[model samples]
Target: MFLNNDLGPTLEKIFNDSDSLKSLSIALGNASIQNAQIIMGTVEISNISDLHQFVQCTVNFTSLTVELDDGAWVCVGPCQKNPNFCNQQGACQNEINGPHCKCHSSYFEKYYGAQCELYSRGAGFYAVLFGCLVAFALLIIVSAVMIVVFYRAKRTSSKKFELFEDDFFDFTSRGGYGHQNFSVTEDSINTTATEVTDEQR
Candidate 1:
């Protein structure tokens, strides 16, 4: 049957005797007293042994209406006899939720269990930036090497330049000087012949 603070005195009477609270679920709400609340839920007793056996109870005293860690109302289960049990001071911490228990502040939850861990955000950005810089430097170095190789290849494959003196002078002078000399000689001869003929006549 669901039990609230209204039936508090009666529930205590049940707890006074050694009784097992099995298959029992409870919820507490802050009312009347600041930071204090009442639990309400039903207890199912299967056999006579259950009535005498004590089932664990969870109590929550939280200012936050909704818990950020578990997305449930914050509550603490009863102190467990197991040394590994989570609620040491009858206080439930955020990490373990309700099912498991956590150790000290240094510990974090893993799939298998909780272990000491170090928190670091430095590795992420540094790795990416370092990789980019290395790649860029390699690209620049390869490009420079390729450019040098191409320059050397082009210089080696080019045809040689040759200059001949005769060819250069012929191009600059246009006509041959020997042909002009021959024309001058012919003119002189013709003039002499005309002069001799006139004298003879």
Candidate 2:
């Protein structure tokens, strides 16, 4: 017989009266059994006049929560949403902490974007373009240098030819045999001398 205003003492007495039910509650509390169900059947009591009864009970279990390495707690269960929540070319994964997006393995190396669709042509294209530019610059510089060298050589050769002509003309003038009228003057002087000698004879 149990009489109490406190519900704890009344519940203890009721649980002590049933060994099987107490064992089941203990098993459920320790997480030994995950699920249970109850079914009602036709009741037959001995020497009962008018039986009217009402019973209600409430049970609570531990909430399933997981703590991540980042010190974040997340409820562990199936994702109620779609797995493809991430947009195009992206994949979604249900982690212990939460769901996240990851790029595909094919694009993992050189592709990056909101959808992992952008690709890089690597450094080779830029290297080739830079090499071509440098070659063109070198060609222009070499051509300019060659043109300058040829022009200087031609000017020096022209100066040498002019100097040789000047030297030749100076030498002919100093020898006194290159005057235009010297031969005519000498012939007239000889004619005069011969005339004078014949007269004397």
Candidate 3:
């Protein structure tokens, strides 16, 4: 039998009389009353016990049903049932359809997966992060090596050019005197040739 209204008064009468019912078990359905609105979910119940304590307990009943079991009537009350439908990293929200799993606010930053299981800074993230770090380090090392090589090459080239400049200056100074002697020899040869031609004429 399901009792929709007069739940509190009927339960009060049952609890007032101890001999009215025995071995009564309340299978509280998975429905709750919040702000005069009924939210339904899975069904849950409590162990068979005396109705005195249940009547005193503050339980919002959405559906009250009675069942006969072993010659005793069991009056089931509305129990707050926790379906735990939410995921490991989420909390369950009771909606019109059913319980919905929603990720916590703290998980919004890095977690976004089927059940909010994946994190942004997970293994893949670390792998890419380390790869970038290694690449940057290698770039710095390569740049340093190039700078060193360039510096050494520049220094070697400067030294070679300095040595060549010294040799060229030395050769030019020596070659100037040799060129003057060659010019003098050529002039004497020309004068001798001119006298011989005059004799022949």
CA lDDT scores, all candidates in order: 0.46, 0.55, 0.54
- Per-residue alpha-carbon lDDT of candidate 3 for residues 72-181, written as tens digits (9 for 90 to 100): 55544322143333345666554434445576544224555544565454565677779999999999999999999999999999987776674564444674653243
- lDDT by residue (45-128, candidate 2, tens digit) is 432221213211122213223423244333342232454445454665555455555754442234456446666654666777
Candidate number of the best TM-score:
3
Cα RMSD for candidates in order = 16.6, 17.4, 16.7
TM-score of 3: 0.36
lDDT string, candidate 1, 100-124, tens digits: 4343331222222232232333454
Q: Model 2, residue 44: displacement in angstroms? A: 42
lDDT of 3 at 73: 55
> Which residue runs does candidate 3 get wrong by more than 4 Å?
1-120, 166-190, 195-201
User: Could you tally the backbone clashes for each prediction?
Assistant: 9, 0, 0
Evaluate model 2: give its TM-score: 0.35
